[model samples]
Target: MEKSIHKDQVERFGSILLEIGSLLMSYGANSMRIRVTLNRIAKAFGYNLELLITHRALMLHIDDKDDQHSFNQLKRTSPHGVNFRLVSGISNMSWRIVSEKWSLDEIEKEIERLKSLPHYPRIIILLLVSLADLSFCRLFGGGMIEMSIAFGATFVGLFVRQEAVKKTFNPYICIFFASLASSLISGLAVKFNLGDHPEYAFATSVLYLIPGVPLVNSFSDIIDGNIMNGIVRGMHGMVIVLSIALGLALSLLIYQI
Candidate 1:
């Protein structure tokens, strides 16, 4: 928002700022972090920012110090997901912007690059998450047999979740299906007496779908005084919990346990 810059340039800058904020919000960043990051970038570019953040959208206003040139935009964010790499990358890029003074084009290109960065291979993630659930089962007093059951159940459940997400299913429905798959698999222990701690295996199998990030972020948002956003995120997490509970209940009914 420098006085020398044309209104068109200011508009473009505003658009980029909105894009960055939307990306952060969609990638599971807390409201405070998104606001702070956008403000940091705007300040570095000699502008002031006012932001309205929500779970599914972002609205921003930008103006020069003298209020000569101004821009306002509202953008709908992408479906919420967790990608800490993108969030941290953008935070670092903002600091770099402050020091190196990048052009809008350069910043746009960097964001694109970050978007294209590949996630960890799916098989690797599957193994790791399943291992983590197995560890959780053991920690919950499950024997080795229960841990093995948990590992297999989590692997299948997480795979279903990945495929459902790729198909663009509703998030809650996807979680429901994943929890159902996991609990159904773990429920086998009860049907066949394969493990001594079948209850532990069953309970821990769906732990992978607990919506931990959203719950934690919601708490952080509330603590930081973003009340509405916090409530929305918390509700989102609660719906996921409900979906999981329904899945578990169905499994229990099927097993009559």
Candidate 2:
């Protein structure tokens, strides 16, 4: 009886480890970090896991290579039914992937799967709140209206199309809206002669949309030995910055004519 119970516990522990690993994968964590997190999770489950994570997928290493085959089989048996104890783990992974330059289709599929998990609504709310904060920071030079609009638009966007936003939304779109909104508002302010330095207000408002912080963070991440993560983040930041500049320049020229 004891032996049977021990075996059951081991199997449960293994399943939990896989679930944790999957959640970490969705967050944009590097393989090493994922493995470390898995180790901690395994410890929580009262088992010791030997795991490996690559950019492509995850692997479990057991004393016998054949044992890994059993683990893989177990994972395949119920890929969708695994109980995810911590929903934030999955959302973190989703955010990580979405921030990277991975194929949009793949990312969309992953997010779709993620949404099927429990607590998905809460995750979506968190994402929208972050986006709203980002938008407000980029609009109206930190005034009450900017804050109100950011909160309102963010809530509306999230509440209206939670699933669609999760499956099809792009962070860049949020940035674009924030920038464009600020510009239009500034233009109106200028028209009304509400302020003499409309250009400065508009420019300052959109400064938050600049990719400088991400770029710096990426560089720091790399310097700290997270090469893959650093490179991905840095590239994303650079692309966003360039795109924003190009967009603003084009808009200004078109408006001038």
Candidate 3:
């Protein structure tokens, strides 16, 4: 009730705020960060906001200074993969909205640009993951043959995981299959006595399946006082690790090696 804001614009304001919230949540910003950032951005435009934040959905209520116009929105999000780049980008955008005093049109345009941003290429990830496992093989006192096998195993597993992501498979299923493929391939080293240490390849190849990001985020959330969100994220990360274990165990069972 401080000042008048146009009633007709309420819907548009709500829509834009909803878009921002949905994207932040989807990109893996912790709930507290998302809530605080969204509230600040709305207030920058002379609005008051309330958010009912959970891990899966963001429910929002916005009221302008006049208190006459209000809007409510519920945005449901699917299980989103971790994208730290996108999360940082969204956080920066929220700050710029306040510092730069961007108008609605400019904000909307910027949001569209952010939404359309491309993820890092799958091929690049495949290469890097392979290289990392190859390094781990060497670190484990493996010979050249073990390193090569680890590289190939990681590459094939990561490729499967990337394809599964593209096809929108369940995360648990993707982790399971990826771990299975990598461990199974690495098992070849032992089957044929292809290396001084075939076991190193087997151990390292599926290291890519560790849900490190989620686990880290879970601890961060917990320390930040969002205990429920932290626990949920922790459980989710633990489940992924368990899936990786299941897949590896299944592979070992099949080979009995």
Candidate 4:
């Protein structure tokens, strides 16, 4: 294991480690992945490190051998949307650091590049969502005309969600609005007798808004013993579901269909 020559260098390394942790957290990495990545990075840099991770914060301690100095870093982070691309990049970077032993500057530059990497276009996401909802409708035995209505309604609903996200609206409000818009459209179709069992489309239209990742991650975290983060993530999913249900109820009341 390498040893740090200076206390200043140890402090800088700890700060950089904290920066990586914060970025991972903000990008919606689960506790397990974050802990593993940080450990790998510390091992690569020849430090004895420990991490205390939670949904709201990350605490890290790094001990450098040469100077027998320890540095601590803590960063508070808010949950963000999951981006598998970011997760994959970070995972790859962690291993690369171990194998290549890159300097801090090089790693920092690469991290910046990864941070700025563009996600898939919104239009593409919208189209895929529409397709998925359409598939859901079909799998649930929706016929041709009902499927058509579902596709259009889900497309619009997802577009509303996309817009809400772009505007950085409160997540509950965004889900509520999206669900309301989708359900309203579906209710209107049912009112007009647009297809056989328009209710199916209406009911399943907002399934796309379900916080699938959070719910699954909650279970994953709990299984891995990060109980607090698991509960927090589960609560987020629960609130989103409740918001969706509220939106649907309001739409049904207002449309009376």
By TM-score, the best candidate is 1
Q: After superposition, how far is residue 135 of candidate 1 from its true place, in Å?
A: 0.5
Q: Which regions of candidate 1 are displaced past 4 Å?
A: 1-5
**Alpha-carbon shift of residue 222 in model 2 (angstroms):** 1.8
- Ten consecutive residues with minimal summed lDDT in candidate 2? 73-82
lDDT of each: 0.93, 0.50, 0.85, 0.85
TM-score of candidate 2 against the unseen true structure: 0.50
- Choose 1 or 2, whichever is better by TM-score: 1
lDDT score for candidate 1 against the true structure: 0.93
Per-residue error for 73 in candidate 1, Å, reads 0.8
For residues 1-257, could you state the per-residue lDDT of candidate 2 as single tens digits? 87566555555546555655665554444445565565644444334467644333556743222342233312321112113433454545534543554443454465466656565467675466646554654554555444444444344433433443355556565555555554554444434544344444444444545665457656766776768767866777787776556545544654552
- Return the candidate ranking by TM-score, descending: 1, 4, 3, 2
Candidate 3 vs. true structure, TM-score: 0.91
Candidate 1 vs candidate 3: the TM-score winner is 1
Tell me each candidate's TM-score: 0.97, 0.50, 0.91, 0.93
TM-score between candidate 1 and the true structure? 0.97
Report the Cα lDDT for candidate 2. Answer: 0.50
For model 4, give the 10-residue run with minimal summed lDDT: 1-10
Most accurate candidate by lDDT: 1
lDDT of 3 at 229: 82
